[model samples]
Target chain A: MTRIDYTDLVGGLGLVLTGAAVSYVSISQYPLGTLQRMGPGMFPAILGVLLAGLGVLLSLQALRRPGSRPDIRIFSPLFVLGGIAAFALVIVPFGLVPAILAITVISSLAELRVQPVSLALLTLALCLMAPLVFVVGLGLPISLVRWPF
Target chain B: MEFLANIGLGFSVALSLTNIFYCFLGAFLGTLVGVIPGLGVLAAISMLFPLTFHLEPTTALIMLAGIWYGTTYGGSTASILLNLPGTPANAVTCLDGYPMARQGRGGVALFMTTVASFFGASFGIVLLTLFTPVIADYALRFGSAEYFALMLMGLVAASTISEGSAVKGLSMVVLGIIIGLVGMDSQSATVRFSFGVMGLLEGVSLIALAMGVFGVAEIIMSVRRVRTADIDPETLRLKAIKPSRDEMRRSWFPMLRGASIGSFFGTLPGTGPSIAAFLSYAIEKRVSRTPERFGNGAIEGIMGPESANNAADQTAFIPTLSLGVPGSATMALMLGVLMIHGVAPGPNLISSQPELFWGLIMSFWVGNLILLLLNIPLIGVWVRMLTIPYHILYPAVLMFICIGAYTSGFTVLNVWMVLVFGALGYAMRIFGFPGAPLLLGFVLGPLMEEHFRRAMVLSRGEFLTFFERPISAVIMALTGMILIWSVWSAEIIRRRRAARAAGDGATTHEAREG
Candidate 1:
């Protein structure tokens, strides 16, 4: 029954602060004249202002209206959060193929009660087929595969 | 006449065993994705984009197009069964289809959606075949200022359709523009947003950005949703999977109407199926005899939107193929594919590559036929997908995203961006803002900037040149009118609601209070 809408407000405010921060840093590095002639920073600064304005509007709307009640956060529940962190980590070591399979297996383990046997099988098949199709078949030039010795 | 001759050659090309197989594969997967909720052709296309590199260019384009149309049919299936729309367009179908499903007429709903989708797609393709040449020829006359104005209109129309406040949509558009600005300046070749990162020199790869923003983000969101849900799974019992004669007769008119509505929007640069579906729903409701039966369960709810959604899917290709402007993300990807194939999709394409153009049109018909044939039998298969617990699926989806991204370039930057954007996407979803406008903005941002800088250069920094050209002026005027029109409509809704609230008093307040 509790409908605080605090998350909405916080999100909006966070976006505004981030936009402001991006703008302040960019502007300090350059100048208004840098944006005057539609230079490198001009558009970004304008966008920053627009984002901040929208964020303010969103926060105001949240203040006036309540939203759905969310459940208590349960430590990111799924193994996918761990999968997420490792998603970027694996790309370099295992190469794109192994990295992706690890990501899929780990991420699925977090949310679903996946059978490790089936998941491993599916991942291995995909790992083999995807790179074959992309890197070998299509000549994508990704550094994921090597010819068997 | 030459074009006609080439159409003959295109048939020869498209009829090849290789093309036929790829086309079938595309449509089959497309329908599969459409039936399964949370994953649509967008994710499928991204995951599969790299694979296209291995095939013949024409074959790749053919497959991608099949998936695009195929996804629309799948959306209808999910809408009819679980009341979960596989695509945003199918949301309208949930109104009537779900009720019919509850009434054990799920077969009728599915049958009606299939027929209607076929009809709508045919209409859209007919329009595409007829109008593209004339439109592209006219579009060729467009200067930089006009191109700038045109891209501007597309961004505006896309943002205006955002689910929440227009301001938030605009914010997303601006964010997209900033991201697009990250590479070397379009005019000056000066590095911006790079921050001296060596990998950023070539700018962000299209595959990376797309996979990150769409593919990875989707998995993250789906993961969160699956983890959070506590509901027991329903043992679905669909009695029949075919339509009654009466249901078919009743649905025909709405199908025609939706197709007509769909193609009109599809031909435009900015409008897409999200708008088409809702418009069809509204039209059907207004035209229905007992509007009271609408949300409860009505065939028009399924028929109208289903037809229009499919129509929009096919015809959205018109602008991308003819005018070199994409109206949606899928179209943009297809456009990118076209470019990769050494075929720039613009005014010249229809003339230069008649087989490519006509052949694609022919394949659409083939693809739609495939969808009609495939959807009914596959319902059981897609329904089984619901039993596919989250534990096993998200990782597979994530792996595809990473592989697709990394395939574009051998850099780790692609993976990093996907994670970053995935988080951003996750946050945005919770805030009630729609993702479509952001995608539209990102796709169009670079094109718009290139046009703008070109215009400025041509006119020696005279921004007024935008209004000087008649085409540019008309486009800008249309954009302004749309912005004003949406705002006025929102205001009207606000006032009407206020008046209704005052009249109904405390009794109505408690029932629907959020």
Candidate 2:
């Protein structure tokens, strides 16, 4: 297997540069030491350094030697991804019911099975129970439908 | 004597019928996930966090604690049986555990791990009783610099101990830090990587990230073939796998050693149980008379690491409860829960809120008792979960992850973030990068940012104040050393491997002459 850690090395180095840029930007806004005790820029600047420093170390390690790189397989299919995407796409449009049904369908596909009846019933139960219990029961208002509701 | 009193107090609250039922439910759920390969307690906790929105704070908390420890016990079962660990902490168990299974000693390994978790958890319960008040108070004195330094040290340790190349591990940590930087800027309240997305304003939910990276990534990894391992029906016979008298004798010291190391390390900010397990495994191997016996079904190896892992898991709660700083992501979420309830956790909690404090402290004991009962009797039930086809189980898990991530903020955008992270996580894994550090960063990032701002406010922007504070200075110094030491160790390993290769070539030539 080809050494795969090198990719992360490159990615890490890129992050360091980005972190430096972010820190620099944060420093300018807060004037480095503007707040005496707890300042806005202080934490971001320090954290930025920590982030970059970690990236640098990782990059060096990756450079030193290459090890086994397993061929990456897309873990979940486009269907599973699509399931999540559907949840996001339809969440506000169709409401939690449609969104949840998408999630359950794609998820059950992990077995790669489309147990339609079970999926439908599961979706129905959750869609009703979720809003009713979390929103109505708790009195935290949520729309049964999205924007239209 | 006080141990008994504290334990009695704990039982009073834990034994409350309501609390007990929740505790059982939490433990059962925790164990179920623990048995599922790739679904971990860390993600599980985040997934379950929303479900507790309706429960009373105390009941919710006690149940969460049950799940936390319960998962540890559950993970050991998977490692011993299938070689696939249920939780990250159970990785150490895989060293000897898988070998034991291959040798048909799976039952023995399972039994030993159970006893170890029981004792180790008990030890942590004792430590929590005696030391929580004092430690919590001492934690109150930690300043901003100290906290930042502490987070840095943890990141370093996590990177150092992570499986595979240390460099890749460090890279993962950096990646996590960057991910953490997403959302609203702590000091300025400015939108960051959210890219003007309203869902991004709340920052990336930890649940989404965790589910994406761990939950979804794992499902992708197993897509090639369902990882269905063979189960020997004979292995289920309890009598088939009892530890021999000699094996039992050997296990005692390692368990104690594990417990001790776990307690000590658990007190530190970043050195959580997972690290403690690795450290204990190394120490146990070094001290053993026959070190070569490890990684080959050695009971001592499993016992020592498994016990220490649980001990560390339990005692880690001390810092979070007493002092406001949580040692891990789950604890951080717990902190959020506490804050949500209008409770500020600090040193004076034990005295100021005795019922809440003592009640929780005491509940640990009851939780441990419940864990043992459920873990043993239902071991078969958990074991049976392993045989359920992954195709059936994983989808439900995916459902849980999706719903859980969305429920983190009741937002749709967060679901997308989870998917993106799941891809990134899978890529990182194939690339040999570690994910645990990302979690550490997520857990600590917000807090580090908050403290940095506070410290500046207090110090009037004088950067030198961080160094001036003795506690903070020492912490930063230690972090610096860890970074340096990890680099040095990696270099040495590289050099040694190179030298050994050359030596083998030379020796081969000499052998030809002989």
Candidate 3:
């Protein structure tokens, strides 16, 4: 007997749910005209149904064999994604310099060992270099430093 | 002859001071990123894409194309030295190249691969020059039916031929198509999955999607994983790069064979340099008289794949330029760049924009020559770059991704989109679903729907019109065969594994009875 692969099962179920939701929304919200003249929703509705069918097939296939489990790491994604979020939050309000410093400090924490002096130095260099390259050289419209208040 | 005139036109444009300067800058940056172990060509291109907005369309394309082909040359340096591919296309090189490095022939490997790359690029460029006009002339006769059929074949082939579960790949393509539908319905002027968000009216930005998936997601995965490799400085010296006459003689035939194979695959839709490199390496191993020496520092192994990838990189432009259908995700991004510049790529592109066509081809020649000159003397500088730690690198890369995403739309919303897609991309990677097919689908989805709707209207709702057309029928038949073959082969492999397991179980039972 084959072992149940939970990863495959969950992934397939997620696909099926997404497909079903898309199909439902497409059919209900928009018009599906005749084959000669397709409405806006016609292509998406067909695609959603096909996706659901494929998802069913995938789930069935998983029952016949085992599949590899995903290798999940928390540290890298947490800090890396966190850093991007921080930059997005800081950029408009605090300007380019603070945004650069924000992302650099946050993302550098993903490394196992964080050197304080080097981190500060790296942030300082980026604050100087990013503006020169992006603002002065490329002439992007963003400001170097701003106060929204 | 007209060919000579065209060549003259190409050289005139390519040799301009501004164009030459941009080409050299592109080659230099391409090598810089390609020599670094963690950075990839796609990430580098997307990060620098915003800078191109300020330049003319022709210059932008010339620079990007330079980067595309230049990376193939620089990738082998790291493969030979550290057994880590600088880009995915060079992964095959590490097998034989690392062994050669251990034997103190690293310099020779680098020199030969560079020469082989130039030769392969020249071969592919010659083919591109000869065949592009012919293919474009033929494509000019195609209608909406023919186009829809061809795009369908491209989507099917791209998803199925990739190295993973065919179902998962197909599902990802479908998901991308749905994502492509999120803006407005162009035909009917109806709002779609936008859900009243103002930003959704213009649809998802391709630059944001590309940078999020290829740039940020990659950084997330590679942050803690990659380590700097220690190098032996003596192996990279200029004096150590000279190869024996025997090694030179043995490599010529393999380079020819590899270039031929690479050209063939490169012209096909839904395949690119990585597949070409792998296939050529396998072919070289099979045709060798002393196959046992393959993994033990064989020069042919490194020569064949390196040559194959460079050739593929050059020829991949054939279909994209002639048919307006990209073979891979990177090609799709290039197409996006052209579209953003208000240039539509299709059959008339060669006739209408002769300068862009010929000039780009001539620049390939110039770019390859520049790479050949740059890579040899810059070996010491590149090796020193290997010592830069991952912690510092990832942070800087992250900063670029943020700035790039922001400038693409000049909105913080685009940055948020990058984060959302970055998380989606990372999750998809963990689930064993390939991202390239999804990208191809996103690029082609809207175009495919437009063609499909047009074809339907032309046929008066008769589904049999697809079968009635000669070209469409043939392509549709090929797509069907590939689908059936993939499913049948997967089933056969599964049953064979089960039988082997059952055989083992029976033998153990019989032994216990005895």
Candidate 4:
């Protein structure tokens, strides 16, 4: 027989860990009063246990019948995530225009190889459009350009 | 009659110049987003959530409603042309729409679907007009126990009906509830899970959760499939839009049947347009004499599902407007908009805010009419819109999402939340868990908790109070039945799949022996 699906196993593990973390926080941090007078943490603690139980059930089911796994590429997520991080870093200090340009050019790299001309054109278009639509039209208070230094 | 008077009031409000302008703008923008694959109406609405923050509630709602239905009209464009669905609602359209396009009947298919959509929407609007008052009146008597039961039913139905592993869907729902709990505990005045972050005190922004999971995660998934060259949209001749008489004759009843099915499912919480569309398609397949034509560019294939989805979109507002229980994620977003404008939606909303209710209903008719007019002649523009490559389109979507997230609370913290949820959402997708339930869970979680707490308090913490109340008992019984039905159905599906696999294996073995 084919090997058991590692993806479901991993998913089951992740869910269990998340449930455990929530349960831990709920138990340690908050007050869980008796059944008659439920405290703030009572509901969350119940939900955490439910989640962990479900995860365990899923793991057991996975052993009986393996499921299909998805193809996970490494670089695309990196570039996409990196682009958002770049925007977050720049939006305050560097300003809207640079942030837009950074996010646009950086995210386009998720396609692996970017056509420089198209990338530049997209950057220019976004730089104009973002300011016009967001700042000028909608009147969000952000300067067009700023130098962090 | 009272109905006529209400209609008159609605028309007076909806026909105002300002409302018209907003409606037109929403339809135009909604079509643009819907035509572009990967930008579903939920993401688009969340991305534009900031834009409406400044408008009057009525105008904001009118525009939002326009966008919701407009997307329904425009979602079919991509399915017809590229076999790609702009939203889950339109996914069924690709079965025959692309085939029809390949056979050079693309224009005709588009025209028929548009007409079918209008028919279905009109039917739904009529139902909405008649039923909203009745449902609202009935729901007025519901106590906390009933409301809790209803919300629980909605969550369970959503988890089971969503197309994936039920366990994973339920887990996601629980996860969403946990996420919803990540703010100040309103009852006790103690901070629950903010982890000392100031942003968590106010709660995780809905726009961030939506834009991240639906918008940003979609971009992440689409990265691998990005084609450098855009599709040629001009090849489909726009002039060939007229349907043949035979096709027209076959479609009318199917449209009506589809509308009825759509309306039924749309009123039920947790069931949305996608389910309505698929169910309508299945019904059409079963009822048709020549069922063999269904997958091979059949006119019924395009007409039934398209109409059903559009009808479903309209009737989905029934639960949201009257009961104040959003039927889907998009409807939940609209509920958020209502709350943002300080208009609490519930049984009392229709009575307290008749102008808002009637005006919104009237605006739906106007919007659908506008969508019909817009879709017919503007097919060329939408088709041409397909030529824009994903690389360009996604960056623009990402930028809007970032801006929208930031604007949700005017804090950068929400933008950070977007990144975190986007990664989490992508992981969910990789593991084949349905995101819709997660969204529904997030939207309804806080409300569910509040109702549950209130019920518990009233009963002095006796859990039996849930079953003691008549309405709550009936609702809970229904929820239980639905859960059992879904579990049974899932088992049947698995057994059938296994049997098919075994059959194939046996056939291969016999072939080798022979």
Name the 10 consecutive residues with the lowest summed lDDT in model 2 chain B.
Answer: B505-514
Docking class of 4: medium
lDDT by residue for model 2 (B68-125), tens: 8889889998888887878888988999998998898888888889899989988988
Please state the error at residue B91 of candidate 4 in Å. 1.9
- For each candidate in turn, the interface RMSD (Å) is 3.7, 4.6, 2.0, 1.8
DockQ: which is higher, 2 or 3?
3
The number of the candidate with the highest lDDT is 3
Rounded to one decimal, what is candidate 3's iRMSD?
2.0
DockQ of each: 0.37, 0.41, 0.69, 0.66
Poorly placed runs, candidate 2 (over 4 Å): A1-5, A20-64, A67-70, A75-77, A95-97, A107-149, B1-9, B95-105, B161-194, B238-250, B278-298, B340-342, B351-353, B501-514
Scored by CA lDDT, what does every candidate get?
A: 0.73, 0.74, 0.87, 0.85
| Candidate 1 C-alpha lDDT tens digits along B227-323 | 3122122323344656667766778888889999998887675577868889999998898887888887788788888889888988898888877
Put the candidates in TM-score order, highest first: 3, 4, 1, 2
Query: Local error of candidate 3 at B363, Å?
Result: 1.0
lDDT of 2 by residue, A1-149 (tens): 33335566676787589679767866776545445654445556765786688677667656555445457544255666767777778777776666666776765665554667766666676667667755676564445565655
lDDT of 3 by residue, A1-149 (tens): 22556677777888899899999999999999988999998899999998998889888887767656678888888888899999999999989999998899989998868999989888988998999999998878898889988
Q: Which of candidates 3 and 4 is the stronger one according to lDDT?
A: 3
lDDT of 3 by residue, B230-296 (tens): 8898988999999999999999988999899889888887667889999999999999999998998
Better of 3 and 4 by DockQ: 3
How does model 3 score by TM-score?
A: 0.96
